[model samples]
Target: MKKEIPLAITFISGVLLVLALFIPHKPFGNLEEIFNDWYIIVSGFTFLLGIDSLLGYNFGKLKRKEKDAPYALVLILSFFITLTWGIVEIVRTPEHNPFGPTSTFSLYFYNSIFIPLQATMFAILSFFIASAAYRAFRAKEINSALLLVSAVLVMLGRIPLGQSAAPYVITVIFLIFAVYFFAESAGVTEPKIKIAYILVALIFVALIYPLGFVYFRQHIPEFADWIMNVPQMAGKRGIMIGIALGGIAMSIRIILGIERTYMK
Candidate 1:
């Protein structure tokens, strides 16, 4: 009954929220606003749960005398120091906040700790990309060769000098591929070879287009503006739709207690 009641509430709430988007009238609109407020309140409570879990895990490691216990202690110490500093600053000067100029305890910890950690994590991903690319290009087949060539062109095309040279090179490359395609269609080339060539050529074109557009933007602005507004906006909209659906799914799971791994 506990599970069934929560699941029923989840399903009903999900449908109403989705429907509220289409009907921008009276109670529906008010209900959506109420839901938004509820979400904010729930999130605030969830944040405390997150902080408790973080502290608990780190403290457990310290208690067990784990190998990485020192690192966990460092993290906990930093967290408490930051929290204490913020609380002291907030309490000391109610009339004029000590953290007014954005040089506060919270901001300092975020800039020093959070930003650098995120950058370090992202930088580490480059090694994985290199490893994957090395594996991908090691195949000796025609298709693999084409893939390797396309990847090299893409990497080259990303650089400043290569991008500058891409427009002239792109035109010649396209013409060569077009001739090869026509020849294959007219029975002058083998089907397999033609297919490989066409695939490589299309990949090259895909890489070249961005470079070419950037190059052309120095001479003509309208084309660049169109690419940014039309294609980029379409891409953004697609991403937003995916994000909305993902959030809805997550919310449903949370409300129904289906995603209770966090509690553990």
Candidate 2:
């Protein structure tokens, strides 16, 4: 009966909310706003539950005298300290709310401690990003090779001397790849295929210096901009559309009571 009642409530609320979105009439029109208010109230209680869970877990660790107990203790202390400070500020100086930008809490804690911590976190993430990029940009195949080239161009476009240096860099890369392919062609048993490969490599190396470096030197940034704005934007929009469709499908499943994972 308990499970059935909750499931019934979920189905009714979800269907009503869906109807409220499409049909903004007398009954359904107020459902959305009412649901939002209920959500806010429910969220406040959920936040208290979250705080209880966090503190309880940390306290358990401390009680066990674990190796990481000190770290947990610090976390517990920091939370209470910050919470007490905010409460004290609220009572002591009502005009200067703790949430205000110019308040003591914002200036001392948020700007001084939080911002630097955030920057440090991102700085650490950059090394991981660089490692991932290095792996991704390896010229394993034609697609990866294109990706490497596109990435290089986009990166160079963003920098000050990138436009001028891009041609030379790209020329050097072409030469290196051309030499590698030419070397590979020497081991090929098929005369026609070997000759074709060698000719293609030689032709590419030959054309890069004259046409690429001379004529297209000034247009590197523009070409990079085109790649970013056109191809990148199209891919991003497609991913976003897929995500929206998935969310809609999930919402429908929940509304129909087909999704019962949340009951657990």
Candidate 3:
């Protein structure tokens, strides 16, 4: 009964919502709004349940005298303090309640503390992201080499001195890779051939340094802009389309009762 009722409710809600979207007239016209209100009401109760779970878990840690009990206590106290402050603000100044744009809570708690803390968290996270990107950008193959080149271009393009310095940076990068490849050619059984390869690489870099510097110094930013506006944008749209299609598939499965993971 429990499973059947919920599944039936889900199917009905899904089908009705789909109908309401396509046929917005009379009975179906207000279904979306009605369902949204019901959802909000249900969400409020779920929020209470979340609070209960949070507090209960923390209190259990405190009771058990765990090593992380202090941190748990801090979290519990902070939650109550913030909640109490919000309630007090709402009662004391209903017009400029805690959640309002110009309220004390917005200024002091949200903007002052929360915003800075969030920024700091993201700043810390960027190091980890950079570390991951370093591994991903390693030029093990042709695709990765292109990715590395594009990433370097995009990064340099965004910086203030990137235009002026990009030429030198790119020249140095080419020189390094040339030297690396020249060194890797130690397996060349003949000294003449090995020296010839090194000479060719050096000459190539020398030529590239002059011509590429002149051209890229003027056009690197534009090239980066094109990469971002075209290639990056296309990739992003493709990903969003894939996500939308997947979401639709999942919704259909839920509607048809083919997916019963929620019941479990």
How accurate locally, in lDDT, is each candidate?
Answer: 0.70, 0.87, 0.87
lDDT per residue, candidate 3, 28-107, as tens digits? 99999998999899999899899999999999999999999999999999898998888888888888868766787767
For model 2, state the Cα shift of residue 132 in Å: 1.8
Best by TM-score: 2
Alpha-carbon shift of residue 153 in model 1 (angstroms) = 3.1
Candidate 1 deviant stretches above 4 angstroms: 95-103, 140-143, 163-264
Best-to-worst ranking by TM-score? 2, 3, 1
Model 2 residue pairs with clashes: none
* Residue 251 Cα positional deviation in candidate 1, in Å, after optimal superposition: 11
When summed lDDT is taken over every stretch of 10 residues in candidate 1, the lowest stretch is: 216-225
Native-vs-model 3 lDDT? Answer: 0.87
lDDT of the structure predicted as candidate 1: 0.70
**Count of clashing residue pairs in every prediction:** 0, 0, 0
Candidate 2 wrong stretches, greater than 4 Å: 25-30, 94-96, 102-106
> In model 2, what lDDT does residue 187 have?
96
